[model samples]
Target: MTSRAVPPATAAVPVQDASLGAAVRLVRVSKTFPIAEGRALTAVDAVDLELAPGSLTALVGPSGSGKSTLLHLVGAIERADSGSLTVDGLDLVTANRRALTGYRRGVGFVFQRFHLLPALTALDNVLAPVLPDRRPGFDRVERARELFDAVGLAGREAALPSRLSGGQQQRVAIARALINRPRLLLADEPTGNLDSRTGRDVLDLLLDLRTRHPMTVVLSTHDPAIADMADHKVTLLDGRLASSSAPSAD
Candidate 1:
């Protein structure tokens, strides 16, 4: 008997855009950290960037190049010491705590390390984002189930992080990131922990998700191949924007 190969499942049809995806704009943005002495270390120098809504952008650079810092600034995880930042017309540099919280609710983050709870099952981990609310009307569990299935972890929801492989664990992380239905996704070296083949698969999954959601994705990576897949590329050097390129139309 001949074995038939099953094609990978595609993401579900996305809902209509509610203006969820946000365009990011940065002007002369800079951030610095104080060092041991009275001196300071600039993580991000004067940099200007513009990201269109619902676009995938790659941030590429070497170590200490400030790629991560730039992502954090956009996600509101880190504040810039100088300059201006605007996302979908909201000024991040001057946003208050309440505004920041609301803005973050519309953003998702995936880290280099799969930040899963060791003791929790895959399903529970995906539900972590909404677990604190304790709202009675929302069906977060159903949403979590759908996300797990979307990431190809349908039957493995009961498995713990310890029992899953590196790639599987990252899938769970991706599912968790989507639990909030975020419009902006920030991924910092998301494929850094997987093997080459597995990393490629993960990247494919990310691209697939982009098609199923109206979201802006900005991922930092050391891989040139990954950068090439993005619609736009931003390269950093010595904490400054070295160059940026947009894909040319055919």
Candidate 2:
């Protein structure tokens, strides 16, 4: 029998407990894309890895190293070509479209570009993700306000993206990512567009948020300094696992 479909964003957002982090497991997973002349480029080669709940992992590599692809795979934006991929026991590789949509709702995503709505206020941007979802018990507005405070943008809620600095915009993006109280958060070069100081500040805020709301965070970055801040570091090269500082899964 098929598993119960996870409620969409229109459903009530569940209040996650402190142990809400999702555990991730991958075994020989691979993803490839077609290229010119009927050729294919392997983005994620056969690889195996595991991330413990509530742990922060850094996917460190140069450009074209598959770090972003791995993040995409985990975020359910791309499907794997072979092998098994599971997060919180949900088999991502094999999940149906509806299931994947529900899974996407549960997984928060932060991007390097800080994908905020140009016309919306910061508070509205944070609330955009769940605006369609009607959850009687949940107060999305209050939660957005709390997140603004958590990200050090409490008073700037009325500001538009154009009025905010890059750092502030990124902060708003971070807050939006957490609107669903996701158990797994994926960040693809989240600090890449900021100045050094602002980047550091964003990273600090992310780590702080992780502590307050327990979740597995997997971020991709080429900067060694950024990778150093993670609990475990995995390096990818030519779509393959080149090295890993993470311990073996028990």
After TM-score superposition, the amount by which residue 70's alpha carbon in candidate 1 deviates from its true location, in angstroms, is 0.9
Q: List the residue pairs that clash in candidate 2.
A: 10-133
- TM-score of every candidate: 0.89, 0.90
TM-score, prediction 1: 0.89
Question: Per-residue lDDT of 1-250 in model 1, one digit per residue for the tens?
Answer: 9999977697543443436377888999999999997999999999999887787899999999999999999999998988999988888999999999988888899999999999999999998877466778778888888888888889999998999999999999999999998888999999999887898889999999878877889999988888888989999998999999965454
List of clashing residue pairs for candidate 1: none
Best by lDDT: 2
